[model samples]
Target chain A: MSHRARSPSTALRPTRRALLAGLGAGAASAFGLARLARADAPPPSGTAVLLCFFPGGWDQLLLLDPRDPSRFTASEAARTRIDPRYDELVGLGYRPELVRPRAAPAMVLGPLAERPGAAVQLTDFAGRMAVVRGVDMRSVSHEVATRYFLTTEFPRGSLAQGSSVSTTLTALARPARPVAHLSLGVESYNDRHPSRWSALRVTSADDLLATLCPAGAVDPVLADALDAYAREARADVYNRRGLVDRLQGARAVARGLDRDDVSRPFRALVDDGPENDALRARFGISRGDFDGPRARAAMAALALTSGLSQVVIASVAPAMDTHFVGNAGHARLLGEGLDAFVALLDALRTTAHPEGGSHLDHTTVLAFSEFARTPLYNTYGGRDHHSAGSCLLLGRGVRGGVVAGATSDVGMVAVPWDLTRGGASPSGTVLTPAHVAATVAAAAGLDPTAFDAPPISQVLV
Target chain B: MGRAPRRLDAGQLRASLLHATGATWTGDRRVRTNNDPSGYALRPATDLVRHYASALGEPDYGATTEPDLDPGPGFLRRAQSAAQGACRDGLRRDREVPAGARRLLRAVSDGDTYARAPEAVRANIVALGRTFWIRNLSPDGPEVEALLGVFRAVTEREGALPADGWFAVCVALATDPQFLLY
Candidate 1:
């Protein structure tokens, strides 16, 4: 009932040779067939996941998918029907230009990528990043699009239709941690997985501590009595549909939480200690910014490095629903989020993993928004929802500095892409959320069939 | 074949506790003192029902129309926390009044230890089982003896007083599947 690994000693251990061979085969051919070819082998272990979500639709032209200013100018806007008014963004003090960082020339990013910041920028990690452009979200509504991207399955109206990718990864992971999956200020859904893999959702570090820490410790006698009664009652219950069993299992988890003192590290979120100061400074989080993107990023770092969670999903951006005048500060909001994301990557890059490499070497980071904004600005001087979206996949098992998929030049519609060749093709498939989910699953050595879409072979290492 | 039983949602659980014991679990707002001058603020004392509503499978109706019917580990642990807090409140209220006027511990007093008064202990256990579970438990039945085992362990081995033992019994009965499920 606990879902704890029964024979951890006999669990499948991933070697460097197996990982390279698996990823090589996956990248060379369709992951569906490749996974079937190796069906007898277990998924590679020691791979962690960090799923970063930026709320509200991000403007594709301003970030992941950029248009050359010289080609799509104001005069050509009428013919192309796409206009990125870079001159209007006065916050950057200059008309932002598309940047291809010298280190990662194949990765084209928007102006915000090169923004000056106290923390690192997206350009810092471009060598380890892969940009998936022109992804079709299939929905225009915020709730529907968010869930669609989160679970890689379209929602039944506003309700999620599948288990979250994080939950899936956590369930498949062997030698589980105390809290296998942790979600901070992000929605996580679990449909059919074991209840133990359900994400421990919290808004902040303080909230996590409060949830894990006992309100008031009862006398030891009372504690012993309650635990004993629970055990006796557990045996008596018929466990219809495993409800009582899950309840009893959760009581054990509660006890483990106290026994392991899992809340001790989270206490540094508010406590004034050397490690707390170092984390705040490293993540570029000020004293009062506890629940912002930077703080969430710092929490993700601690969760991963401290071995508290195997998969962490955090909302690294404030709401960027910039419809009217709010659009003026859209770049600033996105810049802050991107800065926090890079800081998280830097933290992982510097921290050591238990498996003899940096945490970044063993972790895969997927950054996405619900959808992208329209190519053309709306009548309200801001951009509206657009069906075409883009996402970034970085860290382990991902081919770095590569761009896959593309939108059209005129309407910014997603064009059919050659998954194996990494370009546009008239007969190829259009990129969708399912493809991205499959790619993530495959990179983590999970079965791509779980996502019902073939992994994009060109994006894998 | 028996039809599967449905677990109570957070709202129904709260209402049931209030209806049965005339008490609800309410978490107090305690100020968090930290060395950081900027992170210091007066923490708001929100009620536990609202705080644990999401974990208790209560639907907001915006994203989900129906409550999460499957009770998982998170839901069960939160339910236990709620029961622990609510039963403590019930015991506190019972302790403030005379034995005749008590709502939960009417069959026994705070001073009635298992060694001193075993009949009163069995009576209190039966009364609690009937109050929370609506089942007429035999005082000498295995069910009563199992709960008595808990009381005996607490009072004898743990060296806890009768009031603490009663609180443990109250929590066990309230959080049991018989009380949680309809």
Candidate 2:
């Protein structure tokens, strides 16, 4: 490993490195790069996780932590709710009557809590949905808290050591899939995961489909030449020693992918085939929502259904960092971004899984923001950052009907909730991100002890 | 004892192709160190070229933690798709090579570079043996004769452009089993 250069290939062939140096830099703005970083071993499962991330510190008061109209008396709500940054809360604009009842015992709803024609939004899943409120995310800073939520480990020191739940689950679940982990617009991290298990990042559904198929027919001459070249170089490569191991690993991957056989099945996904069009239509892909959150969801559905990948992560940005003129934007996100996910839920429910149950019956959708918005608005006429928050999850194997933990009526202070019962209790521990990590680990079939925290058992089947 | 064949990385593969075809593009700068992960159309980053880097175990020099590629690189934590992707990219290149490189490959007359010329086809095969397989081929060596055999078959197929016969020579020498394993 000394600075010694690649041992000159004593081969009579011209020295490759020296020759390349003779060629001047061709026109190339140079370019541009997921591997997980953790050591824990989570067991694989047929169940998968579709994380719908809501960035920019979502509003807890309007979404997860509902408060009474009395508590928001106009004069007090509009004038009093303030953050340390001197930002003021925007006056509550939605009709008090619009706040509906949740399926959970005492929980109620906000504007975003719309159900398909008044079945009581979020109620049907009440028995299975466990919302852990009062989570002290420790810091209100955006970047750090976002990392804390995704990795479970503290952001201060875990940069090189942490792995996200999506990646850990990906490693555990699909060790041999053609593309095990697929990230379509997800805010992802892949530090320690081997380059082999690294994530395939795509921006659109077409991009996803095109990747599997070829440009056309492959040439035999070229194929033969490449085969010959591989033979020659592969031989000299072994003695090179410094890099042979990884080269061998890459070789194994190539052998597994049968270009003609493996990708031929994927043409159905690419050609706007009837089945895919129907599914896309069901997922709101026909509407402009295709470019919105629904697009990512559609890609996820295709990936899972096609067996192209085992884990698919999608994200949406609500710009909930509402510090200026608008407070109604979160509502728009509810209708536009959040509702797209509902369409996704509907599509998954209708799509049948090859193994028996519907994709919805086996896939779990985990949705949460970096942190919660301040219950009170600051002087900027919007909610500032708040450390306490809640999240929503749905899909098969997830206990969807109940809300876990609680927060206060005034400052939106999180109240400790009992994990066993999914209810507020003075004796309960304040839920932390570790609990979220454990919840995913447990659901995905990992040994829960591998994680430092326990799963919210009340929510798991 | 036979050992596992070492999978050559993108840099090595590109360089070997250039040398095998006698294109003055020696690629010394490239074979020693990677240009950048970006130049590689494979991996998760590019929209094109899938399932090659990881399978071949081509270390994404970019994926490694050290900013610069360490000569003594370790497994960068996970597997990537490498093997087949390169196979596809390489062969596909022959049909779609840049105009200049195509002309250069056609101009390859030295038996030492491609081993197709009857006068030095044997010498050419022997050179490939030493350079690619890291061994010597004796006079009337079986390896050289095998390469010459492939050359005749290919030249017959490409009757109009008989130079293509050299491609067969290049390929046989390149794909030799002894040359493939680490």
Candidate 3:
């Protein structure tokens, strides 16, 4: 099934090009063809949503509402406790159906008491809020559903199997050096797609230079010979694919290294300038504290704020799929790690550009898991896989203090929305991941139809 | 009431011992030792030769006590001559067999042990003993039969002999510098 409608909101106009040229080619190219590009083009204001996926199904009942009596059961009552953050939420007139961070920038979603499967929130970012219910994924396996969530195709067709929303968006809007697309840590298999435009992969920044110039250690004679060989090889590859433009662009980028605007951000970070140090402090990290995952995040954030990448896809190790143990063990493990991750994101939001500007208002953060856990406690004392789950969208574009989906007790099942009216219901309406991907594409100014899915209207401003 | 022993050429004895064991000789004139023997953690030939030489009460052929021979292609030929001389002298002396040697043979005979020593060690020791028997004990006699007494005594104490003992002759041949390098 594909989306048939073109975006009526996006008009292709020629006058727009003349205005863009007057502004700057770099801004125009970076923002894609939709937006009006100005020299001081406000650095392509958009949302930076992170899909924090727990690949295996996460138990929604536990996460959305730990104290739901019908779901938690009498035997499990002792295990359930009201989240301390609930009162802070209630103080804001938001329902205490689920636990939230005590010091979050915004609490836009809460437990839907009537809805069994779905939960959503509205943040303080803008009027934009979303509560996606009843997402029906085709595959039950962890790998399949993960691909489906990011790309929107179930039993993911080979082409879409490893593709993520970030990769697709980056390809559509090819940003420059730092703001293209950066995958931190062990990137998902989906980030490897060749069709993407942005240079999305990096194990380390040091590795990038090494790959470009490997003969740095050799004798002058040997180095010269190797350089010639490399040039020949590169030329042959470029000639075969007729990618002279790309090759030339790469060469130009290499030459532009000495330019102040292009080199500023990289120099600031690698050299541990004051701006970089402040950013690290905000994140509660130091240079020595950089692990594989955190280092990637730091580098990506640096790149993004510096305009080196338009999109950054960063991930931590998988933690959500708790099969054997239930509440006390597995859930706590996930919860604590998530707590740290949220803190890191908060810190990143506070990080300023080297020129003393904040990334918070401009960045849109979207965090979610592959799917939510089962509705009821199973024989293993843990939740099995469930199709319905929750996601958090927080940024300047989000509306705060709103709970989007309804929650209720329906024998054993909890649905996202009302199936009868296609509105809010206890059982949520079937919201697929393709819908989420579509929304992200739209926000980036691309026609969501190009991705064959309609943007979730609830989340769009 | 003893018969006069027959004598055999060192080269023939060395070739016989090598044929008895199955190992390719890499020409190198390095004496095998526990420290730097074959440049690997486990060298079957080096270990075997050491075990056999020690059992026969022969001079530590694996020691660097001897000056380095030019280790040219003739190194193997020289080792064979030296092994023959030592073997003949050892048999004539009838030196008291050590308890460890008897235990090793007993273990091999009883099927309880396979000599797990280095290949070079076992090969050198066995070669020296066999050469002695051929030159001083019996020239035309079966070498295996001649060594059977010592082998039985060692195996009986230790159980089955280690399978590595079978490579004794091959280790001797590989002692040449030409065989060890390249």
Q: Which candidate is the best by TM-score?
A: 1
DockQ of each: 0.36, 0.07, 0.01
Ranking by lDDT: 1, 2, 3
Q: In CAPRI terms, where does candidate 2 land?
A: incorrect
- Residues A1-461, candidate 3, lDDT per residue (tens digit)? 00012212123323422332232223222212122223542343444434444435655554432344444455543444212122222332335455444333233233322122112211222233334444556555565566667666664342234456776766566554422455543233233333223233434433222112211111222212222322322222223322332333332332222121333333323334455455444333435433334444555554555454557665543356776665545444454334334444544455443333455445555556666665555777666666555555545344433333333344223345443344565454555677666765665455577465566555555
Query: Which 10-residue span in candidate 2 chain A carries the lowest summed lDDT?
Result: A25-34
TM-score of 1: 0.85
User: Which regions of candidate 3 deviate over 4 angstroms?
Assistant: A1-51, A54-57, A62-72, A75-97, A100-131, A156-162, A186-199, A203-281, A284-289, A292-296, A351-357, A401-408, A411-422, A425-429, B1-182
Model 2, residue B47: distance off in Å is: 11
**Per-prediction TM-score, chain B alone:** 0.86, 0.46, 0.23
Fraction of native Cα-Cα interface contacts (under 8 Å, chains A and B) also present in model 3 = 0.00
Q: What is the lDDT of residue A193 in candidate 2?
A: 51
- Of the two candidates 1 and 2, the one with more favorable TM-score, higher being better, is 1
Give TM-scores for every candidate, taking all chains together and pairing residue i with residue i: 0.85, 0.62, 0.48
For candidate 1, the TM-score of chain A alone versus the native chain A is: 0.86
Per residue, candidate 2 scores C-alpha lDDT tens digits across A146-177 of 77887777776423236666767776664456
TM-score of chain A of each: 0.86, 0.73, 0.62
lDDT of 1 by residue, A1-461 (tens): 01122222213322422322222121111211222122222232378899999988888887899888888997998889788777666566534688887778888887777775444667878888899988999988888898888888889978788888887777777435667788887777777777777777766665566666653432444555677777768534446566666566556666555444455555556667665676677777777666778889878876776566778899988777777743347787887888888888887887655456777888988999999988887788788889999999988889889899999999799999998777899989999998998898788777778877899998899
Q: Which of the two, 2 or 3, has more TM-score? A: 2
Give the lDDT of residue B125 in candidate 1: 90
Give per-model CA RMSD.
Answer: 9.2, 13.8, 25.5
Docking class of 3: incorrect
